[model samples]
Target chain A: MSTAFDAAEFRKALGAFATGVTIITTKAADGSLIGLTANSFNSVSLNPPLVLWSLAETAASLPVFRAAEHWAVHVLASDQEELSGRFARRGIDKFAGLDIETGVGGVPLLKGCTARFECKNAFQYEGGDHIIFVGQVLNFSRSESAPLVFHGGKYAHATRREAPDAKPRSAALSGSFNEGFLGYLLGRSHFQFFGQIRAQLADQSLSDDDFYLLSTLTLRPLISTSELDAGLAAVLRQPSASRLPALAERGLVAQLAMTAESDVAEYRLTEAGRDTALRLISAAKAVELEILERMGAEDGAILKSLLKRFLGVVDPDASVLWDDPTQVAGKIPGSGWDS
Target chain B: MSTAFDAAEFRKALGAFATGVTIITTKAADGSLIGLTANSFNSVSLNPPLVLWSLAETAASLPVFRAAEHWAVHVLASDQEELSGRFARRGIDKFAGLDIETGVGGVPLLKGCTARFECKNAFQYEGGDHIIFVGQVLNFSRSESAPLVFHGGKYAHATRREAPDAKPRSAALSGSFNEGFLGYLLGRSHFQFFGQIRAQLADQSLSDDDFYLLSTLTLRPLISTSELDAGLAAVLRQPSASRLPALAERGLVAQLAMTAESDVAEYRLTEAGRDTALRLISAAKAVELEILERMGAEDGAILKSLLKRFLGVVDPDASVLWDDPTQVAGKIPGSGWDS
Candidate 1:
C-alpha cells in the first residue's frame, strides 16, 4: 500500500458508483466463444441506440473483441449471479453446459438475462490501459426480472424505491409507536398475519403454543424433549414440557420410548397430528402467498431476504429448530442446548 | 412511436441496466457554473485513474462541458435523491443555496456525496447523439454512505447480496415448516423481539392485551372504545371492550363522560398508565436498537423498509392506530371500523 493516492483507494472510490452487472460476449476468429463480466457498461445515447463498455487492454479476450464485428451484452438478472461469477473467472470453459443463443454476427447470448442488447461495434476510443467500445444497437430485448447490481465490488439486490409521495400515513401522533418503529411493524405484521391463521387453529382447538409445538414436530421425524425446549426457547413463554402432555392427550402427538443412548423422552407426530399440522401449515402458507402476491414478487423476495438476514443476527441459535436428527449425537451434555 | 425499433422501447431496454446517479459539475469558460445529473458514467481504467460520462449533443451545457478544463463527478448518496433531481431539471440555478466546495480548477463540489472525483478533461469522442467526455482523475475521495441506484427508470435501494455460502442453515427437514418459511421467520422475529420486552411489561403485571389497549391510548389524548376496537382489531383476539374495564380497575385508565358528538365511551391514560407505557416502549426500543446495531445499520434500515411495505399490503386499515382525533367525525356509522 503506497502512502499517496493508491490504486486500491481509487478502485474503492470508483466502486461507489453502482452499476448493473453485464456479460459482454463475442466470437473469436478461431470459432470459439468469448465473454467476460463487466460492470463498466452504460448507455451512451438513446436516439442512435448506442451503448458503451470498456475492456482492460490486458484481458485475454481483448484481441478477439477488437476484431469482432458485433457482440451481445447480457444484463444479468438477480438470479443470474452464478453466471456472472462464471464469466468473471480465468480459465475454465465458461459456456460449459449452458444453453447459449447465437445472436447477430454469431455472438453467443445467454438466456434468462434481465435484458439483452445485440450491437454492432461502432467506435473504439483510447482509454489508458483500456479501450472503450461504443456500439450501435442492432436489436435488443428486455424482461421484467429484477436487475442485479454491483456496488463496492460486491453483488447486490436492487429493489424499487417506495413512491416519494407515500409519506407516513399521518403525523397525528408524531412520537407514538407508529408504523415507523421496527418492533411495532414486526409485531403488527406478525400478529396480523397470524390473526388469519389462528382461525384455522381454532377449528382444531389448538392453542398458539400447540400450533408451535406441532409445527416443530413436522420439521423432523422425531424430536426429543430437549430439542423442543431449545427450538421453542424464544417462541414459547412457558417450557414446552408443560404443553406436550395436553397435545399427547389430544392424540395429536405420541410419546416414544427412550433411546438406547439417552434417557430423555422423544415425540413424533402421529398420523392425525401430521394431518393436522400440515393442514394448518397449508393454511398459513396460503395467507403467506396472498400477502406476498399483494406486495409483488420483487418486494416480497427482498422482505424475506432481509428477514432471514435479521434472524441471523437476533437468533444465532435458530438453526436448532431445523437441525438434522443425525447430528443429535454431537449435542454436548449441557453446553450448546442448555445455554 | 414507430412501427419498428422505437425510441421508447430502446429506452426501456437501456433502463434495465441499473446505475448510480451522478452529478457532474464544472465552471463554464465564462465563469458561470454548470452541472447536470447523468447516469451515463463508468470507470474506464484503473491504472491510469480514468473515468468517462456523456451528455446529449442537443443539451444546453454540452459546449461548456466540452471545453471545460476540469469537472467533478459526485456519486450521490442514498439521501441525496432530492439533489439528484434538482441538478437533473432544466432552467433555474441548480447551485443556488448549496454549500459548495471548490475543487481542482475551481469546479463546484456538492456536499454529502458518497464519492467525489475531480478530473481533467483528457479526451472527447463522438457517441452518436451524445458526446463522450473522458477524464483523468486527479483527486478523489469516498465515504461509506450507501449509493443511490436508478433502475428501470425509478430510484431503487441496493442491498448487499447475502454470502453465497450462507445457505438456508439446514435442509435437514426438507419441505417442512422451518426457518425457510416466511411465516415462521416473521413469527420468530416478532416473538424474539417481544420476548425481551415482556419482562418489562411483567414488572407492571400487564398482559399482552393490556399492553395493546394501553398503547392505543398513547396515540391520542383521548381514545373512544370504538377507536380502540378498530385500532386493536387485528392485534387483540377479543374485543377491546372486555379488556378496558380491567385496565380501568388498575387505575391505569380514566373514563371520560360521553362526548357531545358521540355516545361511545372514551378513555385517557392516567399519569401512571402513560408512564408505564412509555417505560415499556423505551425498553422495547432499546431492544430494537440492539438488534439493529447487531444487524448493521444498512441491513437494519432495509429490514424496516421492507416491513413497512409488507404492512401496507397486509394491514390496509393500519392507519387507524395513528389517526387524528379530529377525524372521528368522518367515521361512517358502523361502516369503516366495524368492517
Candidate 2:
C-alpha cells in the first residue's frame, strides 16, 4: 500500500488549496540579487509577527536563501502576471529590467504589488525534501489593489461574492420569467442600458431603426445594401428594404454609385448622420461609465470579459460586418478590397 | 517605526495574500471529532509528501490537534460557505448534522469537498504565538468542483482568466463599435442567444413581438392593457395597441370584459397562445443549456450573477410588472391581490 502514495496525485491534491502569487527576493553572500516565485508563503503567528515559506532543498537558490540574513516577500497584484512569469523562470536575471528597490539588508523589492513584507531570518526547520524558513517581520506595507490568485495550478481572478441575503427574486407565477433567467437578464440589461440613450434619440427625432441604420453606416465609409441587410437582420428585420430608404428620404443617408457593373449599390452616412451618431455614442458611453462605476471595477471587468466569451461561443462568425477590408478580402476570395 | 507593526495593520497586510478556505479535522483521544476553519495551509514538500498549517497555541482544540496522530485536510468547494461559517465559530458541535466519514486513524472527513488529504502527523514546530504542524500525506482524492477562495478577509469566487492572446477585435474605422464596447457586447449576446430560439418561433408562425406578448401574458392570468404597456414599454413600443390586437385577430388572445365601472380593459392568452408560449419557452431553455454548457458551468454562473447585479443597479424598479399581489398592493393602493 505504500506504493499507493503517488506524488502526482499528492501534488494535484495540494493544488486544491488556492493561494496568492508571491516573489521572495534576497541578497546573497556573493552580492547578487536572487528571487523566485512561490505560493507556499503563509502567516505563522501575529504576536511576534512571524511568517514562513518553504524552499525545496534541490533548488538552485536554496543555498543562497539558507544563508541570507534578510529577505522580502512581494504579494503580487492582479495585473502582475507577467512579473510572476518572469520570476518563475530560472538561470536568468529576474531583476534585469525591473525598477527595483532595496529593502531590509539591501534585499531586492519589486513595485506595483498589493503588499510587501521585509523580514529578518529567524529560524529554519527541516521539512523532508524542503527547508522551512520562518522570518520575523521588520516592516510591511499594503495597497488597495486586488490580489492575484493561483488555484488548481493556474492563475485566476477573484471577485467578491454576493451577500447571502441577496438572493435572486423569484417570479410571482410558475412558468413565468424571473431574475434568474438569462434571457430576461439580457433583455432587461439591453433595454435598460438603451433606455438612457433613448432620450437623445427623441431629441434628434430619430427612430430606433433609424439609429441602428446610421450606426451601421459609421462602421464603414460605404456599406453595400447586402452588408447592411446582413448586419442589422437580427434586430431591424429588413434594414435595406425599409429603414435605409427612410433614412435616405430624410437626407440622413445618401446612396452611392455602384463601382461594379451590377444593380447592387452602397450607402454612406450624411454629415448630419455621422454627427448625430457620434453624439449619441458619446452619450451612451457616459451612461456606461455611470453604470460600471456602480458595479465595482473588478466586477465590471469580469462582466465584460465573460460577455465577450459568450459572444465568441454564440456568434463566432458575426464579425463579418466589422472586419477590415483586408480581413474581408481574405475571407472572400478575389474581393480585391485593400485597407 | 516598530509601532507600525501593530497587530491590526500586520493582519491586514497578511490578508493581501489570497488563499483557499479549508477545514483541517482530527479525532481527539476521547473519540470526539475536532475541526476548525483555516487559510494557513500550504504545501511544503513533494518527496516524502509533506504539508503544513499553523494553529494558534491558545485555541481550545490545540490540545487535541497536538496529541492527534492523524488528521485530514478538506479543500472546500464554492458551495460550502455555510459550512465554513459553521466551523469558524467556537464552542459548538460543528459536525453535529454533517454526513461524515472516517479517514486514516479515524479522522473525520467531510463530504462534498474539492479535495481531501489524509495525513500522519510528522512534526510540530514552535512558532511564537502558534505551532506549525507538518503532516506526511498518506492518500488523497480530488473532485472537479470549483474551489472556495478567501481574499482581503472576505469570501471570494475564483474565475479563470482570459487567455493572454484573446484580445478583443478592433474596429476597422475610428469611432466605430468594437468587440470591447459594452453596448455592442450586450446587444450581440442578446440577439445571438435569441437567434437560436428564433426557429422555434418561426414554427409557431409568431413574430418577435407576438412571442414577447404571449410570454408576458403567461406571467399573470389576466393583464390590464395599462400593465402590458408598462411591462413591455422597452421592447414592444405599443404592445397593447398593436401586437395584442394582432394576436387577438389570430385567435391567440382574447379581451376580457370589464367587471368594474372603469374604462380599463384586460387581455389573457387563449389555449392556443398558452401552448405556443410553453413550447417556445422550452425551446429557449434548451438553447440556454447549450450556450451555458459551452461557457463552462463556473463562468456561466458568474455571468448570470453579475447580470442580475447589473439589473439591480440599472432597473431596480423593473420588477413592478412581476410583483406578487401583496407587493403590488403595497405598491398600489386598494388592489386586493395576494399571492
Candidate 3:
C-alpha cells in the first residue's frame, strides 16, 4: 500500500525537493570507526553549536549512533550525492567499500566532504514518529569540496558557481522555531502535533491524547459523521460505551444532519471548537517556525520531510470514506505503514 | 603572464564554476537603495533566527552596509543572475532601474528574488578582506516558485517537484556553494578553487595576497621565480621604507635555480614556508567548510560565487586587496574594458 513506503522513492522525492546534505557520523567512545553519512543535519544551539538529524528510530545503526560518545558531521561534496544516499538508506555497514581515512579519534573521515565537524550530543527530542538528536561540534574538517546536495527530494549533485566573481546570497532562509509552543498542526506524515509544544507548554494536566483530540476538532472542523468515524483514530477509544449523546449534550460537537441518511452525517464544530482550533494552529505555526529556526534550511527541510513522512505513513488518510474512483493511496482502508 | 591570473582567462575559466544568483540591496539612511552582489551568505543562528553574509570591505556600498541599522537580502533566482552580476559590480547604481519593496524596517527588498528576509545586524566579524555581517531575521517572505540557482559558475533554474502529490520546494538556494570545490577536486572543472572557498576563509587570517597565493598554489604551485614575482600584486606598491628583509631573513622561503645553464629560478616554500602554507590552507579549508555548514550546499555555492566575484573585482588578483574593482578599473591599465 502506498508503494510500501519505498525508502528510495521517499529519498528520491525528498532529494528532488532539495534539502541540505550533512555527513553525520558518530565517534565511538573508544574512538574507532565513526559511521558517517551525508545526512541533512541541523543545529539547535545557542550556548553551543548544537545540531541534529533524524534517524529511523528503529535502524540497526541506531545502536552505533546512540552508543557513540561523539558524532562528527561532514557537509558532503556537492558532487557527492551518491554518498549521501548511501548513508541515508538502511545498509549493513555504511563505511563499506568507500575511500575513507582516519580522523581525530580515529573517526572515519569522508574523503571529499566539504566540511567535517565533530560534535558532542546535547540532547535528543522525541516526538510523534522520529527522534531528533542534537550534537555540538567540537572539532571539524573543512575542504574545498562543494557540499553534496539533497534537493528535489532526491540526492542531487549541486551546481557550481556560474562565475567565480558572483555575489553573496540573500537572507532567503531565515526564521526561528518556537520551542515554547505546546502544539503542532500534525501533517499526514506520522508526525503528531502538540507532543513537543505541550511537553514544553508546561501544562501537566492536559494529556497528549486529549490535546490531540482538541487539535483535531480545531483543525478539520465540520467533520462529516463518516469522516469523523474514519479519521478519529480511536483517540479516546469511542469511550467503548455510548458517550456521544452525553458529549453532544455538553455542546462539544453538534450533529448537523437530522438523521444519518446514507451512513454519513455532518458534525459541525461549535464556536468553542473554532476558537480552540484557531489557538492550536497559531501555536503550532509558531512551533513549526521554531522547528525551522532550530534546523537551518537544509537540515530543516530534511527535518520536515523525515518527520512529515512519518506522518504520511502512520496517519489515517483524509479520503478514507470518500468514493474515490482513482483510488487515492492514503484514502485506502488500513493502508498506513506505521510501525 | 601565466594564464593563471590572466584576469579575463581566469574569469572565463572560473566562470565554469556555477553558483546561485542573489541581489543584495540595502536602504540607505536617506531611504535611497544601495545594492551589491555577494555569494557569501550563510545561516548562523536559529534560536534568534539569524543569517550572515560577507561584503568586501572595499566595496562602494561598504559604508551603507556598515552603517545601516537594518538591511534586506534578496536571494536571486536563476533568471536573476544578471541582477546578481549587476549588483556585485562597482559604480553602477544597482537599484536605479530595479523594482523593489520595503519590508520589516523599510529595508529594500528586490522583486523576483525567490525569498527575502529582513534583519537587524546581529554580529559582524572582520574576516580577511571582507566583513562578515550577521543579521537576526526580523521578518521574512516566501514564494511558491522554485528558487533560481547558481552552479558550475552559472545561473540555474529549479525544476519544480514532479507532479501529483509532491510538495513544492519551500527552501531557496542558500547553502550549496562548494560545488566548484568539489568539481575542482573531481576534475570536473578547474580554476574553481576560489568559487568553492572564497570568503569562506574570510574568518581566517590569510590575507588576500595569501589567498591569491593559495589559489595559484592550488593550481599547481608557482614553481618558477618569474611566475611568483608576477603573482605578487604590482598595483599596490609597498612603501619602500616598509620593505624589510624579514621575509628573506626568516629563511621561510628560498629561490632555487631551475637548471644549471638557465638563470631561471623557482620560488618554492621552504619547510617553514610549507608549514605556514599548510597552516594557511588548513585554516582556509576550515572557512570553506564553515561556509558549507552555514549556507548548505545550494546557497553556499551561490554565496561563494557572488562573494568571490566581488573579491576578484575589488582586489583583482590580490587576495588581501579589498578595494572595489571599480575604483581601479579605470586606473589599472590592462583591459581597456577597465571602465
Model 2: per-residue Cα lDDT over B1-339, one tens digit each: 122768898999999999999999999999988999999999999988888999999999999999999999888999999999999998788999899989989999999999888999999999989999999988788887888999988988888777665433544455665555677678777877887788777886788778778888888888988888888777675557677777888889998977668777789999988888877877777777787887777788788888877776666666357666664444533221111
Which 10-residue span in candidate 2 chain B carries the lowest summed lDDT? B330-339
* Model 2 misplaced stretches (Cα beyond 4 Å): A1-6, A29-31, A171-173, A317-319, A324-339, B1-5, B170-174, B259-261, B317-319, B325-339
What candidate 3 gets wrong by more than 4 Å, as runs, is A1-29, A32-82, A85-98, A103-107, A112-147, A152-339, B1-19, B158-339
lDDT of 1 by residue, A30-70 (tens): 89999999999999988788999999999989988889999
lDDT for A316 in candidate 2 is 62
TM-score ranking from best to worst?
A: 1, 2, 3
Q: TM-scores of the first chain across all predictions?
A: 0.88, 0.86, 0.39
- The TM-score values for the models, in the order shown, are 0.92, 0.89, 0.35
Per-residue C-alpha lDDT of model 2 across residues A1-339, encoded as one tens digit per residue: 122557776777788899999999999998999999999999999989999999999999999999999999999999998999999998788899899989889999899999999999998999999999999999999988888889888888888777666523444455665555677778778877887788789897887777777877788788888887787667665557577777788888889865657777788999988988877877877788787887666777788888877876766666457766565555534221111
lDDT by residue for model 1 (B1-339), tens: 111477888888889999999999999988999999999999999878899999999999999998899999999999898998999998889999999999999999888999999999999999989999999999898998888999999998898877666545556464467665678878988877777788777887887878888877888888888878877776775687788888889899988987688789889999998988887777787888888887777677777777777766776555465755455455444232112
- Best TM-score among the predictions, by candidate number: 1
- Measured over all alpha carbons after superposition, the RMSD of each candidate to the real structure, in angstroms, is 4.1, 4.8, 32.3
For candidate 3, write residues A248-276 as lDDT tens digits: 56565566656655655555557764554
Regions of candidate 1 where Cα sits further than 4 Å from its true position: A1-4, A224-227, A257-266, A317-319, A325-339, B1-4, B257-265, B317-319, B324-339
Tens-place lDDT per residue, model 3, B1-339, is 122323343333222223334456677888787777765454433444555566766677788888988887666654566777777677767778766677766777787665566778766654434555667666655443345554434455332211223422121112211111111111111112232333444455443344444333333333453454443333112321122123335554555645768776545446765565555556545544553443344443333332232223323333222223354443444211112
